[model samples]
Target: MRATFSRKAALLCSAALISATSVMAQDADIDSTNEDFALDEIVLKKSKREIQTETATSVTVVEQDEINDRQASTIAELVDSVPGVTIVNGASPQGSGINIRGFGANGTYGSDQKVLIQVDGASVGSEELYRISTQLFTDPALYKQVSVLRGLGGSFEYGSGAIGGVVLLETKDASDFTGGEVGFRFRQTLQGSTNGNGFASSSILAWQPTENFEVLGNFTYNKQSEQKDGDGNVIGNSAFELPSWAIKARGYFGQDREHSITLSHTDSQVQDRDVPYDSFGTTSDNFGNVDRDIDNSATVLTYNYDSLSSDLINLDVQYSYADQQIDQTYVPGSSPLEGGPSWPFLEPLVNSNHRYETSKFLVKNQMNFLTGGVSHDMRVGVEVSRRERLDASAAPGGTDDRLAVFVVDDIDFGNGLTITPGVRFEDQNIKGNGTYAGDYDNSAWMGGLSARYAFGSGFAVFGSAGYTESMPIIDDLGTPLFMTQSEKARNYELGFSFSNANVFSDADTLQLKATAYKTDIWDITSYSNADTVETKGLELEARYVHSTGFYTDMNANISRGEEFNAGVATDWRNSPADSLRLTLGKRFGETLDMSWEIVANAKMDRSTTPTPSFNAHNLRATYIPQEGAFKDTEFRFGIENLFDQTFTPHLSTRPAPGRTFKVSVAKTF
Candidate 1:
């Protein structure tokens, strides 16, 4: 009920700092027609995504309403609904990796991730071992907003060479429940699923003692038995028991409340006893089962200052630290221990403890001015981060430090014409000690230009081009290969967008956005022998809504690419399979709404072996009364994989979950 959104309307309206309307700090009305579902611009009391109807970028924002309606059991199910985004090894928490446009790192032995995943703007996740994951793990119930930017445009402020784009997860604040007023509120949700026999209990408590302060805390407990495919085969290492909690608080000060400070922390963990050693797709005990305890935690402190009378002094500062620790030990009754196996199993591996941590400090400011009769909005920022890996069971340990400065400017020359330019200067150092003592350093620059022209007819065209580079990291577990140079890439994107109202009737609206992109990267990776890789893809999004409650939303994506070594194709994993999804829905008055979604994926061409294609269907519904006894309560039901298709995803080895029946109820007090 607290979410407001706008689609990308122009190329220069940075989605990271969205603005809805001119007004600020407005109360959101729940159980009412809160806001437009397809607005040309979105503003949410302050801190809203204001992508206009003619936006040219491929930025997608998800609100709390959709999150609740999905009833997702994990982050994997919550995300990946977007086109060109896929999860690697999604069967278990230990290996659910992120892949965007075929450019993510996972199912590998080193931490060479290309995608940037962050919670509250704090980067997280590291993959240095064979079985460890390179994705963040948390309770989705703690978040209020989810943003996904799909393209190579994030390298400037998000990372050194994040060609796979960025994912931002924003947690719910106390103001969400009490509407920024002095009050106390609590909400509880109970959910159950049939296929995996999964059950979850989530609770939240919010309090605002005064107009200047607010606080919120949430806790969740979720558990599941081994999941089965449509064919009724047990998924390997798919069951888990998770307990997570988050606490956030904020205080406002200074004249006219122009300054504020916020502090937040979150912790989540999972414990598995005698699970499959190959958390991948294989159920065969090639090595053996083990006991694993994975814990993830993060803490963040942020400050914001905006001048009420001036438009140039908008500043933000943040300091954050995140850690992911995995402790796994040999099981006495496991396959290797019981069978007394040979070869690798005879190497005697036990009590393996690995810890990955990230510490970051960031400062940024925005200013508006006029130059040469053109209106300009400029933003500049500095980022510093320390990434460390500590391994006790064989994998190598090292640290990576990065310092970067980035600046972007939006120049508007009237007549619906806006051009944005950005640049980044970065330096990175990776170091190891003792037996693997070594140091690698690199400095690079990245920049790009984007232009958009919107006509009075509600149609827009935009284009962008940029270049970036990726620095080297520490060597893998016992591998002796190290690189001296960084990987480089040149990226290009072109798009068209249109938005119109009263297309079908006086109460209907339509929006469409499409993009085509290509990226060329050259360098030697830690494990790969390829010299160059090129990827190209197309993404499309379309939606239509009417006053009668009938609506439809659709997304389609196609990706293709290849890696070349001496003119011979060697790898194609950078190309995700083509995917499409369509959702149709209707609102039965203000008390109920329902949606049916159909999703399909084409077989992947990323390897020599052919990965099969598959399709799925889902149904979802939510009911909330306006003036009845259930005004403050909600009930939801869903059916996923409705046809029981037993097919695996292109990037995953485990079969997809079979037919799942889900139901949940939430009550507010």
Candidate 2:
């Protein structure tokens, strides 16, 4: 069955790509050089071409400079700076997880990992939530920018699993084709209470050919070793504390290379202590360790046609592949009560592997009735994706095959108001092998509508509503111990934004944006659990950029969520009642900058479940030296958990890292 599905998927993808290529070739009058031909202007909402300010959905774009200035090293760190996102760092780099708008369903506090991750334009995650590591994209030096879409309005463009939100990592590309940049960064960290020390260094180089065709690539490697201290010490008293390491590489090609291709790969390994069966009055004398690793690679190809002069068309094709592997072990110590009388405490060593491949074909057309004042922007596309899973145990291997086709239309009703409506149809088949046995066929249809009105200048109000669906991860469907059903969601949102120049003066300007959203989800797939949930929230962000050297900005978000069993209400598991974040920063002269950021998170105490605790406070400063080879060099230092507050972020199992100070230095050339 799997073989048959693979052949059919391949044929379908080839046909779509061939058809799109033919359309581009036949449109001889189209101008391939038109900037819009590159799809760079794609507003990213529903994969339609619309002005960013005119879209009803709330989207935030974070540039490379912002990431560098803020010293964000991981997606989790970066999302925390955004108004409505939260991250629970894993026991190590390999176990990290993200929670958006309280959608994580894992039963343990800070244990949920529902948030989905994507690179370029493809999804990357284990069927289970936090099971997938994101260390591959952790390097700040390789990316050009990141975009966060706050609701379901954009889920159509990327598919389901984005019920909470979507994080898109847009990598850097060489512009001139012949130029390249080289840079290096080094950082050191100290844990106040644990007396643990860590140091890391990274370097990156990118190059583009002077010709129209070009290739850009970057590589980063990081390693950190520390002693088991503080909360980590209490959990597992192993002599060799957990060690973290990661390596990443990416490449892009495009015409002098016009076609674009990308490859990204990452490897991560960590040792984590595990304690199972706490109620058995059995505390083991020996510690168990978990070893985890992941590797990912993706490639995308696009063709541009400038020779065609027809307004009837634009075309693009993309293909991507990802492979992930994980290995876990539980080593039993020599304890009479812990490993059983005959050292029977050892858990089975397990290894799992997953592979994913996707191919997409898309065509866009915009026509203006020059004489009729009627214009239409339309897009039609098709995609095929195949996934396979392998496990060391006798448990069944899993395979999923999906085929999807969609179309969207945007009509300008004049008066700065435009209405967009679209629909997508999908068919998926899931099959399990080995001890796990199950076969299911599913179909889904998604539709949405969005409208925008601009009030002259830089101000607009927009709203959108859509139905979205997400499939349960392979583990959730095929695992022996924790199998569950699939999941789907519906999202509604409305938002407004105002941006102006010369507001307080030509030297100062302010931009304000706010949004309110509600999400209803069913069969929500938790990492190793399942439940239904309803999430509602509001988000507000204000930015003030000054022509002068000083600027300040602030943003905040609050959300409410609840869990239900079958159809009845249950405790809100792993959900927070309220969360707020604020940032104030200023630039002093040309060489100095400082910022103070605060995060306050609160969860209503749930005696039924150990609710995550609340915490706040952080301060940072940056200095750039002037003159010489270090002219653009920058140094940053910051302290987190300023008060040394000790609290458990993932229920009572894992405690948040206590007070720590970090310093980093970087130079660009």
Candidate 3:
């Protein structure tokens, strides 16, 4: 199954690229920029600066326009379209995991993403609660750009969990001025061979009253009905059926709005279920319904000041809070055992709730210096943050807190070379009043260096090395039954990029980039069997762009990783050895655009592992009529899992949705 998916992905990628080239050839004045086209103009979220091609670190900027063109509904879907990133779906889009550079978050509790998520420089998770959800920022229409910073540069500025990288999300700022845009979309999906259906809808609105003062607001509501098998039987032997819903909102404000402030909230609930597998086959039973709820909110304020003619400084202050609750009830037949009790028969219930809050402040400064007839652009910053959390259950409650300070500096050499070095220090404390209780304090330091040297106008070589560490999660510090030792990691990488102004023709330009990277993780965090272990691997990504309207991007990564325990057994849900993504986009005339994307991953062959390799292709076409109320209107249609492949990407989890099709329309005033 794995090999077949790989081959199909390769073929579809090739066909899409060929189609893009043909479309580009038909365009006139390929240099046109007023149409808001140009890959180099891509915005980044890491540095809070708009850097053109050839300067920033290893970064992948996925623009909202591109996201809209692909008709993506979730962050996982969009990130999977990019090269070198893997997204594992647990049961539904709401319960998904993302991995980069061979490092991913744990899936058991839906916690453990190695990449940290940030919105406009403010951390998006609760400091006291470690398993916070990313669904708070689900409205993609509220974002201006999504930046994926890979390697050391990412770890240096973002801190430890960023060992794999950092995903910085910048939402629309109010200061952008007095105007508003509103949009709505709906979608339907089919779960491959299952007799189930899913549907979703979203709406968003953003506005600015005057320069420096603006407000943006967004809300999304979604619900999926229970799903059953074609034979009227429950699939996966899941204890509960597939029914869930979510809601989210955010607001932003600033003076003239130079100094900015923002607030956000999110909530979600799901039914309970169980999985059963044997030599015969795999299935799920709908035992009963489980109720899960998550609520999160944050406030951030930032001030930018011009200290001197040649210097700039900025200060930021933020506060955030989150709460999570889970309630589960067991149904009798929900258990796979023979003659198991029927639904709602054996009523067993468990409830857990967690609360988290954090306060942080940081200062940044930039200056220009000249020496030895060479000019240098330099930047420095300092940060401090405090976080606290409380977990409550029927037994008792647990609490943990931490404080940290960090600094960073970046220097640019006039000759197309720039280097950055940074470090952070953290102080942690823990206390418990339940079955497991203790108090401990520890300090950790992390740092890295990155440099880029351009050889000519169209080529550059870059390399970096960094060390990062993550303290144990709050729950991991309880008692022997709950506590786990801390884990740390170090990563090193090197790569190069090539660009040509007119590689194809005088009116055309082509850009190609690739990178090779390796990461070593020690005392890696693992659950179930082993408490700690080690893992390592390499990743590569390449992209080609033609100014004549053709663009192709491809990424591939494979790694060999293992848990060291002579007696303990572990499997694939912990990690995957291989993953790949390919995407192609083209503009056909002034009113039409088309794109295709392919995603595939290798199966976990280890005895303890249970996931199988699978591949899926998506085709999208957009039409903009040249007349009537449809001038700025667009019609989008696409089919996912073109071959109707039925497989699971996670161990014994929900199977991938089978062959799904969707169509939607968007109009911009």
| Best model number under TM-score | 1
What tens digits encode model 1's per-residue C-alpha lDDT throughout 1-669?
A: 333342233312423334444323332211111122333333222111223344445677777877888898777676677766887755456567778887775555323566777899889877545655637567788888788877765447677667777788899998999988899989999999998799999999999999999999999998889889999998777788889999999999999999999999988998889876556645356557778888998899999999899899899999999999888887665664455545354334434677889999999899998878787888899999898888454566788889999998888775677788889999988787566767777789988888888765557788888888877765442444444677788889998877655565655656677889998888756337688888899988887666576778888998888888888976576466789988888877656878999998887766765587888999999988777778858899999999998988776756788999999999988
Each prediction's TM-score versus the true structure: 0.90, 0.76, 0.75
Candidate 3's TM-score reads 0.75
Q: Name the TM-score of candidate 1.
A: 0.90
List, residue by residue over 545-662, the lDDT tens digit for candidate 3: 5544566667676655555555463442355547777767776555776778788778767536556777778676777787886685667777776776676664324455556576
Off by over 4 Å in 3: 1-56, 125-142, 174-198, 226-289, 306-310, 322-349, 363-387, 394-397, 480-485, 524-536, 566-573, 602-607, 610-613, 650-652
Local distance difference test, each candidate? 0.75, 0.53, 0.51
- How far residue 209's Cα lies from its native spot in candidate 3, in Å, is 2.8
Error of 1 at 405 (Å): 0.7
Query: What would the per-residue lDDT of candidate 2 be over residues 1-669, giving only the tens digit for each residue?
Result: 122223244446545654766232211111111111211111101100111343566777776556665554445566565666655543334335556676542322222334556666555555442223333324444456777776676656666556767777766654412343333223222221122354445444434333333344444444343333234444222112222222233343432333333343332233334423221112342323334333444444444332245555455555655554544443344224444553342333222233333333333333332335634677667778877777445234677778887777776655567677878887887777766668777788887888777664557787888887775545555442333345677888888877554567644455677888888877655522336777778888776655554556666777766677756775556554466666667666557777777776676564354555466677778788877767766777877667766665532234555566777777655
lDDT of 1 at 247: 96
User: Which candidate order results from sorting by lDDT in descending order?
Assistant: 1, 2, 3
After best superposition, candidate 2 residue 101: deviation in angstroms? 1.2
Task: Evaluate model 1: give its lDDT.
Answer: 0.75
